[model samples]
Target: MDVAVAGGQTATTSHQLDPLQRGLLTVFRSLPRTAESVPGRPTPLVLDVGDVVVLVSGTDRGSPATRDAVLDLATDAGVVVLDDLPGRTPTGRVSLVLATHHTAATAAQHVAVRCRAPVLLPDGRCVTPGPLRLWVRPEPTLTLTRPDGRQDVVLHDLHLRDVADPDDEHPAVVDVFAHPSGSGLLLGMTDGGAGATVALSTGPRCVRVPAPTTATLDGVTRTIAPGTYRIDLAHPPLYRLHAESAARPETG
Candidate 1:
C-alpha cells in the first residue's frame, strides 16, 4: 500500500498497526475538556465503526491544544489520521480507530498512552467470505450466415431468475432500424420456444413473424418506411405487413 508520511514524503511500504490503539488515540484527541454535565461525571464518547484514537494528557486544560498535539503525533506516525473519543466509565476510555487500507499495530501504542481500554484492530489480511471464483455464465452469441456470404451476429443474455422458472412465459425482443433510403432491417431473438410479431405505426399496423428455434435471429430487407415505427414481439408472435408498400419485394 502507499504510505503518506510527514515532510511531503510518500513511499510504498508494508507495515501493520493495532486497530484498538488507533481508536483510543482518536478518542483522546477529540474529547472536549468541558461540556454540558452528565449526572456525576463528564459525558463519555461513543465509538462507531470507523474511529481513530490519540493520546492527550487527561489533565490538559484546553481541548484544542491536546488535539493539535495528537495531530502532530499522527503526522509523525506515518499513518492516516482520523477522529477519536473517550469511552464510558470513570476509570479509563477507548478511542475510535480506522486506517486507509487495514488496521495495524502502531495504533495500539497510541491507544496505550491515553486509556486502559483494550486495543482492537482488524486482521491485516483481506478475507473474502464467499466464493472467490465468480459464477459468470457466458453470454449467448448468435451468428447468421446467409447463402450469399452476408452474415450478422447478435449477443443475448438473460438474468438467472428470468429463466429460473421453466413455466413462466416471456415475450420475444426485436429491434429494427431504418436506413436513409426508406429501407430497413430487423434483428431480434426470443426464448427457445417463444414467438414474436412486428409492426409499424404509420404504414403497417401488425406483421407476423415466427421466432427462431435458437436464442437469436436476424433478417434483412430493403423495403421499409422511413418514418419511426414500433416493432411488437409478444407471445403467439407473428410478423405481418399492414401496407403493401411497406413490404419488401420478394427476391428470387
Candidate 2:
C-alpha cells in the first residue's frame, strides 16, 4: 500500500514496519536537533545598531521568521539593533535603557511592536521595572586632635544611604584615639578626651572602633590609616588638623 503526503515534503511510501521502527527512524532523521530544543517561551536578546544598544525581551530565538519580524519592526521604527544580551535571562523586567545615540525618540515605537517585555528609553525612562534613580550624594568630613600634639584629619564622604543614622545626633562627630601600643583604633568622646567617630567607606565590615578611654589617647602618639572617611559632627562647624603618624596613612 501507499500513503499520500501533502506539501511535497514527506515521501509517499508504505511498508510492513512496526511502530518502534518508525519512531526510531523519525528520531534518527532529526539529529543535532537544534531547532527542536529551542524554547517555546520568549527569550531576551540585546541588539546593537550603530551607537545604540536595545534589549528585546520575549523573543523567539529558534524561529528565523519571528526574528526577522522583530528586526523589521525595529528598523522601521528607527531603533538601532545591538547584539544578543549576555548572562542569565531577563526575568521579565526592563531594568535599564541607555541610549548612546539620538535614537531614543524612536526607541518606544520600535520596542512597542516587537517585545511583550517593558520598553525603556534612552532618557532613563522605562515601561516596565517601574522607576529607577541612579543619583548619589557626596560624603561628609571631620577632624581629630589630641592634647599631646597628635592629630589626624580625614574626609568621611560615602554613600548617604549607608551611613545615615537618625537615632544618633545629626552631624555628630565622635572622636576616637588609639595609643601606639593598641592593635586597633578605639572610639572616644569629645569631653572625655576620647577620639572622634570616623565613618568608614567600606561599611562596618572594615574597621569599627568603639569610643576608647583617655589612656588610649594620652601619652602614646596615635596613627590613622590614610584614606577618605566620613566624619559625623554635632554642629556644622568645620575643623582641621595636622599630625604625623609612624605608619603612612591612606588619602581619599
Candidate 3:
C-alpha cells in the first residue's frame, strides 16, 4: 500500500504524537503522507467540516458482486464521486479523507486533528453526533488494468478498445469519466475525424484502453508508453461511489 496524504510533512503513525507533529498538524489544514491505511490499498472517502476520516473495510476486495453492490448504492444516492469534500460538504473545511478500515488504529493516515463519529470520540467532543451521511459519502473503487500492465483498483474508470479503425491517429491522452446515472464522456479511442464512433455502454463488459496514453480516474492517475499497457477488469460497472442512507459509527 502507498501513502496518499494531501498535506502534513511529519508522519505520525502512533496516536501519541510528539510536540512537533502536533504543532505541524495545527499549522496545516491537511497533510499528505503515504500511509498504508491497511495491509492493502487506498481509495477516496469524504469528510466534512467538523468531520474526520471514513473507514472502509471490504468483505470482498475485488469481487464482481462487491463492485456491483457499490455501484448500485452510488446510483441510488445521486452524489458524484470526489477526491475529498471541499465543495461537497456544507461547511467545506477540507477535513474529509477516504481511509481504510480500523481508522482507530490508523489516526496518522489522514493526519486530521479530529474525526466525526456518532459516539463520543476517544479524543473528545470536537464534532457533534448527527446525520452527516446525508451529505458525506465514500468513494469506493472499481478494479481495472492500467497502461503499464498492473492491476489497479480505482474510483471511476473508462476505457475503449477494439475500435474498428486503422487510419485514425491517436489522441494525446485517453479521456474517461461518468455520471451517477451511468452516462458521461464514456470513451477512450483514437482522435479520428468526425466519422469516428463508439458504442459507450455500462459495465460487466471487458474493454481495453490502448497503449501510449494517460488517464486520470478522479483521484488516481497513470500513463502508458506506446506499447507498454495492460488492463484486467471484470468489465465496467457504474463510475461512482457507494453511499449509505443510514449513518453508522465511523473511526476518525
Candidate 4:
C-alpha cells in the first residue's frame, strides 16, 4: 500500500514517532512510503491523490490554507488519514479522527484530544503490538495419527501478553509450558518465590490451584500422573489447552 507521511515536526525518521504512532503504522505491513519535498515539511505532499496519509505534526506549523488543503485531500480522494494535527474536522472519510480543543472550538466540529491509548482506526478497531508472535506462536503443527483417526498438533507460545510488562517482579513472569492429554492438562511450570497460585477462569467459574503447597513435577526423568496438579497464579493469562466437558463435545 502507498502511504504518505507529512509534517513530522522535527522527526528525521520514522523512529522519532511516539509509541502510539509507531504501533498504529504496524497495521500496514511493508508499506511503500511517499516522501515529502523537505524533511518535516507538509508541502510537496507526495501523496498519490488517494493514498493513505499519516500527518504527524500539529496544525499550527502549517498555514491555515495548507491545513485546509490537507483536510480537502482527505475528503476528495477518499483518503484514510491518521491526523495528529489538531485543526481539521474530518467528515465522511474512514479516518480515526482526533482533534484538539482549539480546532474543535474554532470549527465547532473538529474536536480532538491527545490519545493516551494507541490510536484506533476510524472503524473503531486498534492493532495489537505483538503481531508476529501472535501469528506464529499459536499456530499448531499437525500430526496425523492414523487413517480415519484424529491428528495431534503441537503449538508453542500459544498464550502471550499484548505488550511486554516492564515490571520484572510480576508473578506471572516465569517460564511455563502447557500441553493437553486425553485425560487432563499438563504444565511444565517453574519460578515464583514459592511457586504460584494460579487462577483459571472458564466462563463464570474460577478455580484456584493447590491450597498452600506448590505442585511440582518430579524430575526431568519423571512425569507426574496426569491430573495430579495445581494452577499457578504467579504467571498470568495462563491458557487452558483442553476444554471442559461442557465446552467440548464428542466429535464425529
Q: How many clashing residue pairs appear in each of the predictions shown?
A: 35, 34, 14, 7
Looking at candidate 1, what is the lDDT of residue 133? 14
Q: Evaluate all candidate structures by whole-model CA lDDT and list the values in order.
A: 0.28, 0.27, 0.31, 0.28
List where candidate 3 sits over 4 angstroms from the true fold. Answer: 1-126, 130-141, 146-149, 157-192, 196-211, 219-221, 225-252
The residue-by-residue lDDT of candidate 4 on 1-252, one tens digit each, is: 112422221112133333333332333221213544556543321334465444443344322333344455456445655554434333433222222222222121112111111112211022232222111011111121212332212222112111112333343444344443332333344453576334333221112221222222211122222111222221111121110111224799
Q: Residues 1-252, candidate 1: write the lDDT tens digits.
A: 011111111121212223322332333223332234356553333323333443323322333343454456555543333444334222323443322212223333233323333232322121212111111111222222332433233222111101111122543334322211112223323344455333222222222223221212223222322222222222111111010111235999
Candidate 1 TM-score to native: 0.16
TM-score, ranked from best to worst:
3, 4, 2, 1
Q: Is candidate 2 or candidate 4 better by lDDT?
A: 4
Mind sharing the TM-score for model 3?
A: 0.29
lDDT of 4 at 25: 36
User: 134-242 in candidate 3: lDDT tens per residue?
Assistant: 1222222244443354544343454433222223365343333422223422434454444433444455323344544555543445564444233322233212212
Scanning candidate 4 in windows of ten residues, the lowest lDDT window is 133-142
Candidate 2 wrong stretches, greater than 4 Å: 1-53, 59-67, 76-78, 84-252
Greater-TM-score candidate between 1 and 3: 3
Model 4, residue 45: distance off in Å is 26
Looking at model 1, how many pairs of residues clash?
35
